[model samples]
Target: MSPTQASRPSTGRAARPLAALLLVAGAAHFARPRTFDAIVPRSLPGTPRAWTYASGVAELALGAAVAAPRTRRLGALAAAGFFVAVLPANVKMAADWRHRPTPYKEIAWARVPLQLPLVWWAMRAGRKV
Candidate 1:
């Protein structure tokens, strides 16, 4: 194998968890659309519910694509984009949950910085496939 190829992960297992995460997260959108809508940031146009469903669809698509070896690369890139595209929602969640109960409040706020790690994970998955 070429040096570059040798240096890369030898197996596709690295991305499996990421794919599963995308799938579960995507499903949650449909499962409880209202929860997602609550954090849809008023600054954005269109109903928050619409945005929630749209993002959910995107997540499902990305999850399916990334799970297949043939489409992994493109899916990974899309995953990264999706993660970034939803950052505003996370921000809104953090802000709205500020006055919520203890653990709930902290949990919501934690999702804000959590995006950075998620982005890095996406990048890694992208590079692997």
Candidate 2:
């Protein structure tokens, strides 16, 4: 096989974990929307529910795109951007939970940094494509 082809990840392999993560997270938004709604940054326009559902839809679509080998490159790239875009919501959650119990606050705070690895994974997946 050509060097480029050989270097590429096995078809859909690199993208599968990311795709599954998005799919599950997307489903959670709809399944337990109030949880997601609570984290929507108050600064964003429109109702929290609206933003929650929109993000859920975007996640589902991105997951599907990433699952397909033909679309994995663009999908993974977009997923990286999506990870960055949601930082505000995570920050909002952290700030809002600051007064809560230590465990809750720590969990919320942990999510903020978790985005970095997710972004890195998405970028790596895109490159492997």
Candidate 3:
């Protein structure tokens, strides 16, 4: 089989789940913080309130873009980049280890692994498109 044909099935199967996951994660980013405090990475310095909202909005837009077949590749790349960009927040959270709406284990350890799959999924989604 050719390179194109060989790669088709792997990517196509991944797109839907990846898109759905991105959408939900993006929504959560926007919605989860209101009920919780100290989510904006206290280490960021200065008021981070606006940053949280802006990041949430960006996530939502990227998620929607990833779901659209025509734009999915660009969107996936954007989403992946966004994940990388926000990783410092995760590091800060782990470092300070302060109050959390969820358990520290869940937020820090479990969710950290999820980032790997998210990145892979985004790349796969991009390929499928």
Candidate 4:
């Protein structure tokens, strides 16, 4: 191994688990309406199906990219963007009194705190060799 590669943190250990999580989460988003009800903001207008699928595809791709050392930075950025984009869904779920998703309650609230750490972890792991 080169000096740089040897000095850098191990990306394989940290990044692969995150990548797997992203893949599973993205798949769930894509399959949501079929396996579960739509929890997206009904007030957002237009079809929710398109948005969900698009985000899922993005997440899946980004996750895979992050797992590859060459593309880790780009993947980290993508993951951060994905997390930011989806945050509103969680906020909407919590704020909409009449439209609370049953199983999403604790999770919706948990996301706010969890997001920062996840983002940080991704960035850190992505930078490592």
Off by over 4 Å in 4: 1-8, 34-37, 42-45, 97-104
lDDT of 4: 0.73
Name the 10 consecutive residues with the lowest summed lDDT in model 3. 34-43
Measured with C-alpha atoms, the lDDT of residue 116 in candidate 4 is 80
Q: Each prediction's TM-score against the native?
A: 0.89, 0.90, 0.73, 0.76
lDDT of 2 by residue, 58-84 (tens): 999999988888889899999999999
Q: Candidate 3, residue 86: CA error in Å? A: 1.3
Local accuracy of candidate 4 as per-residue lDDT tens digits, 16-101 = 88888888887887667543125466666667776677667887898888878788777977787777766777666556434556
Over 35-114, each residue of candidate 1 has an lDDT whose tens digit, in order, gives 99998889888998998899899989998987888888889888988888888888888888889899998898889788
lDDT of 3 at 55: 78
The Cα local distance difference test for each model comes to 0.84, 0.92, 0.69, 0.73
By lDDT, the best candidate is 2
Order of quality (TM-score) = 2, 1, 4, 3
TM-score of candidate 4 versus the correct structure, residues matched by position: 0.76
Per-model RMSD to reference: 1.9, 1.9, 3.5, 3.4
**Number of clashes in every candidate structure?**
0, 0, 0, 0
